[model samples]
Target: MRSSEGMPFSVVTGALWLDLVYTGGEGDRSCWEALHTPTDVAAWAHSSGVVSDPSAVRIDEADLRAAHRLRETLWDMANRLADGKLPTSDAVAHLNAVAQRADPVPQLVLRSGVLELDRGRNADGAQVLSAIARDAIALLSGPHADRVKRCAATDCALLFVDTSRPGARRWCAMSRCGNRDKARTRRRFEKG
Candidate 1:
């Protein structure tokens, strides 16, 4: 799913369209994608409360191409959002523009909030992501909602809420990024 250095950065980059930057104050991320294998899809579905993991699933080259296309959609949106907060002046407009310019799958599903789609190797994977989108809207859209977020760790592109005690979490894991930062701080202190 990921290398030692980090995972792919732009997996759910479109979430930036929802103001979910991968880097910010809280240690949240904008997407929750696992590596796309048939087995991985089943595990994800089972974990996410899907009726069952689709063990009967299979993905082909066409599916891989569609996935790559989905990746591109997220990447384009993220790159645009790299400029600032959600494009308030043209949030939907920007999305629309991207939709028009980008490939077909995102264009069809994004508008209707029907993101849980099935086109590639596993129908379960698409369904899983779609479910995630719905859950995200429910969790993040209202006043009592937890703000959606992307991890600032650079390696993790996954989305989550900063549910820490103080809600000041700044990495997906303190033991991971937090420890790294602490070590760097200690190094700096020793140098001084």
Candidate 2:
């Protein structure tokens, strides 16, 4: 739920895995590399709502690499679904393996006079990644599997779950790609 500028592929899709996959970007010049370092991974986990404390998470080089690998596999599967195809067996197996990792232990915390579930302070990178893997499994296998779609914007390769009531969502975000597209169309009509 962060700002689009902070994370281009924010939780508008309501899937942590999609947000992780989107950290890479659409392979365009504006692509965002949010997982460049261990610290970056920690920051992403915190900002993506996976972890409550970035400093409490210990991310090493191996964890960073693993995150990249998981992100790539998720991205591949998302692209497949977006293209009206199913994910490959190997990708599914990879996702299953990642999902098997130790998950973060949930702790009820009192925040602003409300109790909410938050990950334990000892939550590591693997645990955070496992949470994302589980989210991917749910989104891709549950009833919303068919709702997965790619943004209609030609320049944007972002994938999002169509949570609209009619399931007719096209752009990644109305303020971002959708507005740009509408403005583009308006300019074309005006010129004509």
Candidate 3:
């Protein structure tokens, strides 16, 4: 598995719903640059754990486009939630269309003395997109709907679920936005 660092997707959000929104950053810091080609899509799917076997999955330009479109819709929906407003009707419809596509059905199997659940061996790009759409829907309608938030960093547009006990998480990641904000605060104090 590839680390979140250097990958086109940010896995630091701790939830697939937020991670999908983080795919395209705010302003000019977008991370979907690597998703322009089929090969890049395959790499991102593998790194993001969207597909268990990247070697067997096939992707094309259409699939890449659909994935990007879904990413954008998800971003819009998440942003609306962060603003304490409902997701746009178009965004909901788009998510529903993707969610109704080829979704992976998990099956339980007994291997030796252990029982394991699997989404089958032939997971494809559509299935991955469907899974992400379902996750977004769940987050939008679930109990934690009010907990979804955008990062506090002035220039960062990443979204995250505030999973802390007190629900006071600010930055997307402590090592990234938190550290940067702290440094800026220290500089301001020194100047004062």
Query: Which candidate has the top score in TM-score?
Result: 2
RMSD of 2: 3.6
Candidate 2: give the clashing pairs: none
lDDT of 3: 0.73
Cα error of candidate 3 at position 8, Å = 12
Instruction: Kindly list the per-residue Cα lDDT of model 2 for residues 1-192, writing each as its tens digit.
Output: 334457443338757898888677445412567778998988899887888778888889998989999988988898899899999999999999989977778789899999987764788788888889999998888878888898898887667999788899998888788888999999999999
Q: How many Å off is the CA of 159 in candidate 3?
A: 1.7
- Tell me the tens digit of each residue's lDDT in model 3 across 1-192: 122465332336756756655455445536445566767766666666666556656677888888888877877777787888888999999999888867655567788989875552466777878878888778678778788788899887667888788889999777777887999999999999
Question: Model-by-model lDDT, in order?
Answer: 0.41, 0.82, 0.73
Every model's TM-score: 0.45, 0.84, 0.78
Error of 1 at 183 (Å): 0.9
Alpha-carbon shift of residue 136 in model 1 (angstroms): 3.2
Q: Is candidate 1 or candidate 3 better by lDDT?
A: 3
The residue-by-residue lDDT of candidate 1 on 60-148, one tens digit each, is 44543333344344444333433334424343343334333212121123436655443222343444344433433443354424434
At residue 96, give the lDDT of candidate 2.
96
Q: How far in Å is the alpha carbon of 43 misplaced in model 2?
A: 1.5
> How much is 123 displaced in model 1, in angstroms?
7.8
Which of the predicted structures, 2 or 3, would earn the higher lDDT when compared with the native?
2
